[model samples]
Target: MAKEIVCRDAGYDCDFMIRSENEEELIEVVQQHAQETHDTEMSQEDIRGAWKTV
Candidate 1:
């Protein structure tokens, strides 16, 4: 099944969503997005916890 992570779901005011069939890829994308766009860096575990499973 495909899974997605929404920035808003992670308590961000932005509406960015990351999707991937792979969990690691999803985390990588979300981590990068959080850093580049939000100026926030997150660990893999934190990233995993922040995203809503969809």
Candidate 2:
């Protein structure tokens, strides 16, 4: 099963899907989520850190 991570943006839960076995892919998914869904700008470093636990 794919691992899922929820992030809060604008006081809403932004659900992001992260497939296991790849950290980079998860990071990219999170970046897109933050930009398209959350409308919050995140730095590359922040994105990397977010996916660290997922």
lDDT of 1 by residue, 1-54 (tens): 667788887778998987778988888888888899999988988876665555
RMSD of each: 1.5, 3.8
Model 2, 1-54: lDDT tens per residue?
Answer: 343445643246545455555656766777787788778787767755454343
In model 2, which residue pairs have backbone atoms overlapping below 3 Å? none
List clashing residue pairs in candidate 1.
Answer: none
lDDT of each: 0.81, 0.60
Candidate 2: stretches off by over 4 Å: 1-4, 8-11, 17-19, 52-54
TM-score per candidate, chains pooled: 0.78, 0.55
Where is model 1 more than 4 Å wrong at Cα? none
| Cα lDDT over the full model 2 | 0.60
